[model samples]
Target: SLFRGQDWLQLNLEELQQSTTISGLLLELVATRDIREGEEILLDYGSAWETAWDRHLKAWTKSPGMYTPAHVMDQVASKLRTDEEQKEYPYADNLQTSCFYEYEQDTATADGAASSSKKKKREVTTIPWEMSRTIFDWKNLRPCSILQRSDSHHHQGGHLYTVRIRNRPGLAPNSRIPRGEMHLVSKVPRQAIRFTDKIYTTDQHLPQAFRYPIGIPDDIFPEAW
Candidate 1:
């Protein structure tokens, strides 16, 4: 099932402190609504990591090395695994400690080999790339398009990240994802005409489709960008 903006079932992470009876990294699968048999469960991973790529892209345009894919993976790795590379990436561990989980190297599978067999130490930073390639299998995932339309007037809303696509049940047959604000400039020539068979409507369908830019607060994490 696809991740919906508001899912009936949610995956929540909670702290497993000594005062609590929960052990290990607390992972709870909660249902906000009653579920019938054979129904699918869905969860939203939140907007923080969802927009991390866009943040990294903008940051990379300014400071190439610091926001490089490798560096960003290092940042995610620092939280996911160990921050042993703290000497090299002092600011990489931006994720809060409440979300941290130790890397269990022994849990990794070995191809038809004995469990006692020796294996080389795995690099924590590469896990992000591996996850992007393997478990997530992003290439086979749903296809998402980035769309933008020029406004006749100089609207600041066109430059802000206010618009977002909603993936929910019971939408119109011809429904389309909202056009994102022009956060990044198109490399294509301005005179170029790009035609598509798809049709998208703005500020007409869902009330949540077009929100005022000022309604959303600025992202608090400046370092993320």
Candidate 2:
């Protein structure tokens, strides 16, 4: 978890479930607004710790010296990306060349505006979940800029943009190569959107890029989804 005191953005689990990742849990950390090119992304880590403690920590601690294996964590992160799921996530189609979301007019009126006034507003055709996932999963992913605060109460928000080659390929099926970064900028009020459980379950596909070779369990958290 990227903890940034109270100044950090909220981790939207529902949103995270939309993207293809190597973890059973895909955490979508959204920016409150259009962050600048070089702003830092701060998050409230204590909140997540509190939630994990309430839900899983107590049970996790009972096992003597038992901790989540790194390989297991990596496998969970590298799940498959299916075609059916792409129908729900348009941004998944954008992974071929770039994973950035672009707003384009589907239709226009005689006045060179949207045919319907209600449709004139900028529509995010897709959320670049791949970009967000990379930022969170990649070991070598360096933010364009970072800022540190001596005190937690002093809030400092941030943003970033980067174009980099994949350090590890085949992390997920049909994963983007030479992936680029994109931000979910908003001008209107934020939507209360969340990802469903169906969107984040494990896939049957075998591991492709074996960076951390770990044995797959027969019953690998079958109930997690």
Candidate 3:
């Protein structure tokens, strides 16, 4: 269904008149030249379609353990009992254990200071799922310098922080930074201790309109893609 070499057939659109029994439109694939026996039919779908397909092929990547049997995966998954064990396993690369934290703020007194019993209690929980690794190492990450403000109650004071991945050894001098090399600078409060992931049920917590699957069939995909 792609124009591999020179296209052997061309597309033609024919419109029928109102007086005819068949009054709609018909699309015909006419042969461009003489064809040999048992040759595959190829159509030139135009430049736009070809460009889009080329882009998709360039961006596509094979999923982890795509060709492996389900029984083999079940056998491998049964042995992994701990989170550390699962993280080190090669087959469980897609599976990541994310921790969730709950922060409880202490009550403020009439003197405009936090009470003496300002105990910060955190509830830690781990949830594992199939998530692609964005940052290879989280230990090397550090927050940027915070800008000081005279007015402490100001909304914009000391909120924004730029975080970067450290110790990138193989980068050449003066090369443009890759898109995945940097994390998004966000305006988060200094008091906020940790980030957590929330699980949403399909078509319930997540809207049905945004629940469409994204992928293309394997047959038409190019080998060099």
Candidate 4:
């Protein structure tokens, strides 16, 4: 971490000297004075580091409201019922607008020659807001295979199963999780999706590369990630 205030320690470098052997380089920090107990240790990174830190602070800005762990921007955009509201949206810059075109081929005869293809007709339209948002129905999802079932009986009257969302054609790509990825979901005999009580007792149970857990509601999160 870069500190903008005064630092307690100073950085110093010294060369190592050896007899009847090759010398090596060494780096060390010598405290100017005694440091109080439980006091934070900070280093003076010099004028160059200070200048860079100042520049970063000047350019840094708060994150946009539309940014979230699970991208729910479409849901927010869908709330705008009228064109006036869509035009006046404060975060309209985050939404994407694309033009879709439909083309029709036409055949025409010229100078008694064989039928020739000509520029027939074309129609261009923008995707409606209703169709742009992704509607995920958990009830429609099913287990990928029978082998995905777990033998763990932790959830009373419920079973743990692996599930995934089928690929949907023409739908916008999800920014969070990719398509066809498996996820753990628990469900009772006659109920909607329920939360599972999966816990890690040891580091070996965790994935090789994993991110720290975030505080996000299960409803907002996509079915699979």
Candidate 5:
């Protein structure tokens, strides 16, 4: 295929990390809800992809890589094998950061056939992704997600991360994952990886959605944009 002619080009999406506008807006809203450190946060992969692409366009004024369709597979190789890759991902069943990105490599299949096996994976990077970082007032900053994990994922059916902050569960009044709900998180594309998506709502619907009381300090964010 395309890589047959060029191999290094396989590193196409290596440089980008995507985040969505809705994510940015919601993050702010989450922060206002007094989000504390180490809360499990989850955003849509598609939205994240869109954000990353937007970042690329803003800079290059064109698609970052694709580099085009020919090389796209090489860019997203790791995520294919769910069981294997998912096991390697950071905070797998816990509440910590989750990363979703593709890495290039050579591999084999079941039939003893040798072929290219690109996989998309989720894992934690070297840089510790802190959920608190997003609360700062930065203009046009890069988009990423971080969380305070609580439970752990064990071989057997073990308990998940408790998702605490400063040793407290209710620290962040309005949690990235609703107070009593389960949150699905993964690692970010770039170095600081962490980790979904569905449902849409306008500002007016905020109250009934998460239901964190208004004006609560370190509790929940303002409903209006």
Candidate 6:
């Protein structure tokens, strides 16, 4: 919004209002980055339009937080490069490296399979009690992820909350992560956010990165995943 060199509107917009830190906003913007499928990631630029130049070399030029966007671009570019320079790679094989949740539904389902028309367009009413034990257990709760918003307005008609399932490195190569990609949990809990609260009753692999403040109970989490 640089019109008269001063008067302007910042393009900075977000789905959340609680983010207050520069790094937090920066990271959110980075998370919106579109990295094309099937790409080997790179993180640097040598000259103005250079390939992934070593950061040690371009440390003097590029801004601090900008590296993420550039790296994502380079990764997409490399992904599209000719096969001569590329090797066989999996198509979104390791999501932990990307943690692209809420981008789409689970791919485990058979492609092109038909679902109920009402179920297709309508919002999923339940979280399959066995699936979301904690969220179901709550006396009153709100969905935390953006997918629900896509189907219906929030209970409060305000913005919705999000939970990012960050990368977990220790799972074996073929480990079967028996959990849905993401789920919604009430942002502000009526009671304190602990194991007794609700979320802890479900799988504990979830990250603590909730838009609303919440804590993990030590009993449920013998060790942080």
On TM-score, the leading prediction is 4
- All candidates' TM-scores? 0.15, 0.14, 0.19, 0.22, 0.15, 0.17
How do the residues 89-116 of candidate 3 rate in per-residue lDDT, one tens digit apiece? 4333222222111111221112232222
lDDT of 1: 0.27
Between candidates 1 and 4, which one is better according to lDDT? 4
Tens-place lDDT digits, model 6, residues 1-225:
223312112322342234443332111113347788996676432243342233334543433221122234324532121122223532221111121222123422434323333633333222211123344343322222222221233324433222222223344333322343333222321121111112232222233211222333434321221
- Clashing residue pairs, candidate 4? none
Residue-level lDDT tens digits of model 1 in 1-225: 334322222323332122343233323455778899999875544565446645655644332122122323434431222234344544322221111111123322323212323443522111110122242322222211123333342333222111112222333333322233111112112111111111232122222332222222344222222
lDDT of each: 0.27, 0.29, 0.31, 0.31, 0.29, 0.28
lDDT per residue (tens digit) for residues 48-104 in model 4: 666766775676565533432213442333221222334554333323221111111
| Candidate 2 accuracy as TM-score | 0.14
Separately for all candidates shown, the number of backbone clashes (residues 3 or more apart, or on different chains) is 0, 12, 0, 0, 40, 3
Candidate 4, which segments miss by more than 4 Å at Cα? 1-26, 63-225
Q: Where is model 1 poorest over a 10-residue stretch in terms of lDDT?
A: 123-132
Better of 3 and 6 by lDDT: 3
lDDT of 1 at 58: 60
Residue pairs clashing in model 1 are none
Summarize candidate 5's per-residue lDDT along 28-60 as a digit string, tens digits.
333347656998866444554666656655654
Tell me which of candidates 4 and 5 scores higher on lDDT.
Answer: 4
Which runs in model 1 stand beyond 4 Å of their true positions? 1-25, 53-225
Q: Lowest summed-lDDT stretch of 10 residues in model 4?
A: 99-108
